[model samples]
Target chain A: MRRENTRIFEKETTGSFMNKEFIAINALLTVEQAILYLRENVRDKRNIYYVYIINEHDRLIGALSIRELLSKDSNRLVSEVKVSKIIFFKTDIDQEEAVKVFRDTDLVSIPVVNENGKLIGVVHVEDILDVMQQEATEDFHRMAPVSQKLDGGLIESTIGALYRKRIVWLIILVFINVFSGAGIAHFQDVIEANIALVFFLPLLVDSGGNAGSQSSTLVIRAMATGDIHLKDWFRMFTKEVVLSMAMGFTMALAVSAVGLMRGGVTIAIVVSITMVCIVVVGSLVGMSLPFIFRRLKLDPATASAPLITSICDITGVLIYFGIANKLLNL
Target chain B: MRRENTRIFEKETTGSFMNKEFIAINALLTVEQAILYLRENVRDKRNIYYVYIINEHDRLIGALSIRELLSKDSNRLVSEVKVSKIIFFKTDIDQEEAVKVFRDTDLVSIPVVNENGKLIGVVHVEDILDVMQQEATEDFHRMAPVSQKLDGGLIESTIGALYRKRIVWLIILVFINVFSGAGIAHFQDVIEANIALVFFLPLLVDSGGNAGSQSSTLVIRAMATGDIHLKDWFRMFTKEVVLSMAMGFTMALAVSAVGLMRGGVTIAIVVSITMVCIVVVGSLVGMSLPFIFRRLKLDPATASAPLITSICDITGVLIYFGIANKLLNL
Candidate 1:
């Protein structure tokens, strides 16, 4: 709201926020003349943090701040002082990715280059901040088990729009959850013989779901921030396997205490062993699904909590029942 | 990584990122003297976007940029060209809040003020970007059913650390899920009489959990972004009631079709009616818990997916079996 006057930054395209009237002096211009040119020609100079240097082709050669330029000898050519170490984004780069570059490089402003590497515009750090916030809000929305349309800011959406966005997912999840019912049905005899087995149904499957949800959410967020890559699949998988096993072991020990009280030794052994297996399976499924989605060129966040939970439901049921049948002699 | 040499910015304290070396000129200093002072004293001027103007008492009065000073007449007093419209943060402000201010105001750098409104330092946008990314990662970690320590950057955390962080949540959730088992246990006679009724347990309860997860995730994210404040509770609650009812009706219709094929007309009627009630209950519970947490001065993100799912599972089972008992005259 403080930036009401800076509505240009809110535009979807980066070009709208570009300062076309920027001071891009020829590399040969002396610092004093470059200062004179900036004073005489540049208007709307609210965010002129740096002065760009270009060659005959108007391709960006280097950049220097006004402070840097003023600190140096006014008699020297700008080419003599400008730092050639530059980080820039292409004109067509996503604004979110542009913000990442700025954050990674810690630049006050980044030059925009065309396909020919000709300098066209500059993206100020302030503008990139806005884009980053918007992208973050969108990512949160996408990661929820709701429609993509709700990815827009909640305050900006109408009630009708919110309903429309959320209903589709609930409907799809309802249909998908049918498999969970069928999975339970296939193991009906096991439950019919030992009704106590039914009591652990939500507990067993939910453990898997919870473990899976944790993995997918972490993996998705790390992937988004470029903290993890597709190439790190081996490391990621290995780490998840070891971590989940430890996690599963801890959870099994905790829950087996409860199982010992309620269902005796046979039930305790079945539930404890199943806990370890389900958690490992859940974590592996959750952790790997995002990588698979990325490899398939899909948005990794589409592997949401509910989707992961629903998938875990089937696998969890099969594993829990299979172990119970073998151990409990169902 | 570009800011590796600028190790201070990565600090948890905003004061660390403050540029105490900033050009704070007196109101009467001529633009020439201001520029000369900057040239003589400043070092490591990588992000000197603004020049703070202070009084004799060293209290900040206004700000002027180097570009503004250079473009002005050399003899003009700094105060004559400086703008008093300034935005700033306090030294003790949360880093996430500082990032929000940067995004909202679109400032290249924000001054850090002391208790007496004296400018102590400046927070460059680049530093704010790092804080923002960390906060985003933390939010993702909190929303999951994992431990907070795992919120640390994926690449930086050890496997043992990740396991420790995540195991706490999974173990707690397993204990919480025991109530879902109890809820199912209470309805054992109804299930034994009708084996088909047992089939929809995962479907019915998971639908509730999924719907609840969606609502909680959206509310938590909106709260984090400052889009939905605690003051907006009445409006948020009213909107959620309508939206969830709509979602519930849609899900009920979809699932009842499956129920009819699997369990005949009575089961269809019971499951369909239960679907609507469970969804509405789940959504309302999920939507309001975050508000309640905020009102209690707690982190709204404490209403995590696994926590909500465990809560919903108990209620979802009661609703489904309660409806079946009454409708089927069991």
Candidate 2:
């Protein structure tokens, strides 16, 4: 059905997938009469789960399931038997927002109305399951920062297409990482004085990126699912301060042991202090990127692991060497 | 309702969320009489969408939607009216598998049966939205390699809890990255000869990790969504070879430009060669870990960005230094 669409509703809107074969009964029809009307019209409708009630203007005024109508008085008009408090979507509602409606109302189908409240179509739960899956897949792909939408399966995508999608981010990131190289070059004296500092370079920088990746992934995913919101940043920041400090302290203890074994007390202290500071910095940087993205009206999911890692690498290099320079007096 | 469970269905099985208040009718009864039976009993039932048909032995036989019954012959026996080819789940079926069933069938609800084929309960599509969201969240957290599941919202989790979750992966990764440090230490002779080599180290190594991360994340997400199965690995591997070579060549070009400006033609040639080799190796490592994890019956999602980055960092260090040793001739 989707392949037949010229546009593929890639806007991911409720209107794009709305079923126009919906059967809306006259509000004046009795339960028996509505059954007769539905029996004649709803034979091949995919969204046969419910019969909506529309008034003179064809506005969706109420809705009731056929199962619920079964227990109602047959002579009573559907207007009297229907659930008057209608939960519905406008034609332009985002698929994700529509999904939230389904989650909150527990309704199998919803009427899609125009802004004027006239029923134009219906959205069924059947299509919504696919929508949720597709939305989640997009988030996963975007968080990878792969420009290709994975419209088809990965195996089906051509090598050129895959390369095109992947190279964009890798190129951008590689250039972004030049700053980390510059950061290293800027602190060349510190590195030259104690060449042993290079041993913990990958270990320390990767730790910062790793810690950042964890926070960014959590925050981006939480935002996607509506679990966390923009307003919660202050509270989340406070929470992260304690979390990163604890993480930083534990990481410092662990790395200092490696520091002591490899380069004695001076190197041990430098790496340990760097570890604590960088972890705290990396985590906060990771936790904050999504919020910054959201504020800038970019997708929070694009605060991806690679992007955060590149940014953190620069910071980690500067911090690691700065601490070493002061401690070792290079 | 989930909170009331002494167990929160942490196993995430279908039985954990099934609605036991389902209505079933005697197959011997006429459709008219069955309707009367349902109208009396289904008023308070949560699984009101479908009424199942049970035989004399209480074995599951057929099921029909009340909406479908509205169009059926009133006096027809339910055995004759019902659709006998019923879709159902056994008590122990996983929730993820159940979600697949819903996606495929487009049914609002499905019956759950015991081993002997007695209808014990029903699972509704309403509950499935939450299940998919939860499953997706778990995949997100585990890919972050956070051990603590985001049981409540992230903002709601204690600092201690968040710290514990974030620290486990960070600690493991730091130890795993010891190989990278060891790899650099072993190459001390190569680095001591050309101090300029240290400048491009982070940029080049992170490119490999960044590229590799893209591949691993795509594979892991595709596996989770049933987009690609384990059997497709060879086909995907062939595709990846071409894809990675293209990406490797592009990244080499991008970085060699930096290599040329920073350290003349000789450094450029070494960095460019290292870039191509490391990117290819990293991508393969990233793509292969998920398949290996799946083969071991572990979650492929654990082939997270950070885990793959750490492993690739070790490989990248070795590849970078090994190439520099031969080319620079220290």
Candidate 3:
């Protein structure tokens, strides 16, 4: 078996191997060779459709259908009946590009080739679909701000299997939160003096998280769709910064109104001002973090919405309190 | 012009109209005709070397080529000369299923038919790609725990535009925070009685938000990939609950260690128990919200990660303070 494997690999490399394994008999092969292969080696030909044909260089040349073979003289050259022109992928192409090619071709299987144009492997459409599903799952996980791995299972099993995958990031975040917590703790005196300021803490943190999620989602989606690229990072950040400001200003107005309705004018103004600043910071962080991750050659999805929000939670609180202390003298 | 427009609309209803919007001379006329009138048009044509032939009833009967059209007798009947045995898509099929069909067929385009065998639309590979991107983006956003609009601009004229999108959600959260703030403010006496409790508040909230973000990201991702369906909601809930318990218990131990180093046994126990319960609740809420949104026929991606964390933030604080008030007797 080892010797045979070596022989097969050698044959494949030299591009002279003329066996069923090297031939791709089920997709665009010559009619004569396909029939000969079927009669001699293929025990089950019920589902087979087309036989693939390759050249001396291992480049795909054409295809021959089973029906075509049955209609032709058995002795006829396979080349005479084979349909020319085949769709395939170059090996170095991006996976997403491969998916697009598959979608465009609508082929059940496409041949993949190396840089030298030698056929290396076949990428089945089924596999592309699998990749698509996996990618979609990853994007979802990234949005959740969870540490991503391929295997997605039940929470119980996955927690065990993906403990490090999930917790490593969370622990990092936890440590980061310590700084945020410390910042808040450092402002304990302010809280003690103006206890009402503590009333808006959740509101400020929540708002910043929400804003961050929105900006990050748009950026991530844009990147995934080819609607935006890493080169567009600065553009995206600029856009989010403006959009967040307008949104923040409007939100501040609304919060101020709510604050006035609930508390006095002082509380309303403090809450409103803090909200605008927190949101602006959140949007900036959310918009830029994905780009930063991308720049670091990381998956942009890694800077997930939830993770961004968590980060914003720390910053939002710090900003809100800092602004409140300066503005309200708390 | 009005008369022509009326004629066009009438012709469309009767399936007698051929769209003259663009003349693709290289395309198989029959396929092009189907796309011209169909709501969904074929987006690519690089697969299946030859385009299949169809009859007026839209029944697949043969295949033809650009070469044949250019070389064969122009007067030859397309039906008489076209190669037969065409592949296609059954209408009413799932879009994702259609993607699978396209992948398998290796055709540039597939004809879509309804139950009555009438061609309704064409699902182009490009459209599938768009759907894949959109679906992935939505998942990315949902994992973030905040909802975002489906349509938004990626470019910004000024920082204000960027700020506005983020600020809206932040402000909404700020108002929501009022309730949390009120909760914290209402419990001021608790903080005043035990100042150290205030020190742990930020840590507790941050931990809870982090845990919830982690779980929500996983559940949202699983659902996005069609791995976990609505039918699996119970399983998902059960899994999350158990996982959260374990996570909560582990976190309690860790926090307890910190508490012991900082304070005494009473503070350690209080903080530890509060951390465990809050983290567990946060995970449950975070994991469940996306599923709820999906059930409501809303995009689960709209359940942004930040939103979940914010919700967790408020809930985490509530749980912490509520438990602390009861246990510490402030």
Best by TM-score: 2
A175, model 3: CA deviation in Å?
1.6
Model 3, C-alpha of A104: deviation from truth (Å):
7.4
Candidate 2: stretches off by over 4 Å: A1-10, B1-10
* Interface CA root-mean-square deviation for model 1: 1.7
TM-score of chain B of each: 0.91, 0.95, 0.69
Residue-wise lDDT of candidate 2 within B271-318, one digit each (tens)?
A: 999999988888988898899999999988888878888888889999
Which lDDT tens digits does candidate 2 get at residues A158-205? 887788888898899889999998898888888887999999999999
Off by over 4 Å in 3: A1-97, A100-110, A148-152, A155-159, A162-165, A261-263, B1-111, B119-126, B143-153, B156-171, B261-264, B290-304
Give lDDT: candidate 2, residue A319. Answer: 97
Residue range B53-78, candidate 1, lDDT tens digits: 99888789999777777778889898
Ranking by lDDT: 2, 1, 3
B141, model 1: CA deviation in Å?
0.9
Instruction: Report the lDDT of model 2 for residue B69.
Output: 68
Candidate with the larger TM-score of 1 and 3 = 1
Which residue pairs clash in candidate 1?
A: none
lDDT tens per residue, model 3, A187-213: 877767767776677677777777776
Per-prediction count of colliding residue pairs? 0, 0, 55
Give me the candidate number with maximum DockQ. Answer: 2
